[model samples]
Target: MIEILNPTSLPQARETGALVADILQTMRSRSAVGTNLLDIDRWAKAMIAEAGAQSCYVDYAPSFGRGPFGHYICTAVNDAVLHGRPHDYALGDGDLLTLDLAVSKGGVAADAAISFIVGDFTPPESVALISATERALSAGIAAAGPGARIGDISHAIGTVLSEAGYRINTEFGGHGIGSTMHQDPHVSNTGRPGRGYKLRPGLLLALEPWVMADTDELVTDADGWTLRSATGCRTAHSEHTIAITEDGAEILTVAGRAQP
Candidate 1:
């Protein structure tokens, strides 16, 4: 379903967005070498409850994923990209970690994701992968505004990844988000401009750009949730939720420099 937030709803949405951003930043600070994935999940659950908010992933049961994700957040590491279910593994130095989170507060929801290196060690490939996604995400946000087309956003995002020498994957991309975690208007990473849904004020969209180092193909882990690169190459993902306004898009799930 496509949801357009009313002016009154925008406040709640902002609060929810701030909550998601805070949780992600807190998790990033706590995560370190030897930190268990399950511990990260526990921290997410506790934070959500403390904020009096609800986790969108905990009960998320999509056809592509195993029913009832049963986790508060997605903890993707190294080769893992999307829908990464927390496991018993401990993080190691130089591991690329991605944290995707969605939360609801006051009946409004916001979603966001961030990919970062675990410790002081930053592999050039991993850093490049993460940088490409972040740049692409910013480009997508810049292309979004009133009277804009979804294709414009897609084209901007795709151009960045393609120029970075990464193959594009159409299987999953950004989507309209509000009231719930996922919604209509599937925003592909790459597309033609001046096509698809037209942007309007009050519309919320989660723009994510993710890529694998070598292959565009993905393989599901035995856990039935984590999606990894087909060639076991390193991966990175960057996302932010933005609201279309009169002048331009305002990033709701703002983190660091994830601003338009």
Candidate 2:
């Protein structure tokens, strides 16, 4: 379904987006070496409940994943990339972790994701990978505007990642997200501009560009949810929920100067 929201509804979407951003910021701040993955899930659950919002993932039982995610947040550590289910494991220094979150408030929804190193150990390559995704995400957002086609956004993002020498994976990419978490207009990380769905005001899109260090292949974990690189190469993911406006695109998820 392609769900669109008027100006008033857009505020609610921003609230949802803010909630997601705040929670991710909080989790990232509290996370460190020896922090347990399950503990992070617990923190997310508490925060989501406190916000009086609903989690789009807990009851998510799509064909691509095991029924009913039954978790508050996705924790993809190191090799893990997408749909990372929480488990009993402690974070280690230099571990690359990706946290993806989505929530609905006032009947509107927003989704976003971030990747970071666990502790003081920041690997240069991992830092570069994460930086590339963020750059691609920014480029995609800049390309999104009223009357612009979705392919334009995709192409903008793809140009950044490809030039960085990372392989793009299209099996799972961005999509239309509004009343529901996932909707129509699957936005690939790489695509030809001037093709696909045309953008319009009131349309909300989640543009995520993720990549594996050495290959585009992926493997599912035994838990049936976490997606990892086939070659066990480190990975990174960056995402944001954007609203197309009459003038341009508005990014719903972003942190203040104090946030890192």
For candidate 2, the per-residue lDDT at 30 reads 89
Clashes of 1: 0
- Candidate 1 lDDT: 0.94
lDDT of each: 0.94, 0.91
Q: Which ten residues in a row have the lowest lDDT in candidate 2?
A: 251-260
What are the per-residue Cα lDDT tens digits for candidate 2 across 162-244?
99999898899999998999999899999999998989899999999999899999999988899999999999999999999
RMSD to true structure for each model, in Å = 2.6, 2.3
**C-alpha lDDT of residue 73 in model 2:** 94
Tell me the lDDT of candidate 2. Answer: 0.91
> Once superposed on the true structure, which residue ranges of model 1 sit more than 4 Å away at CA?
255-260
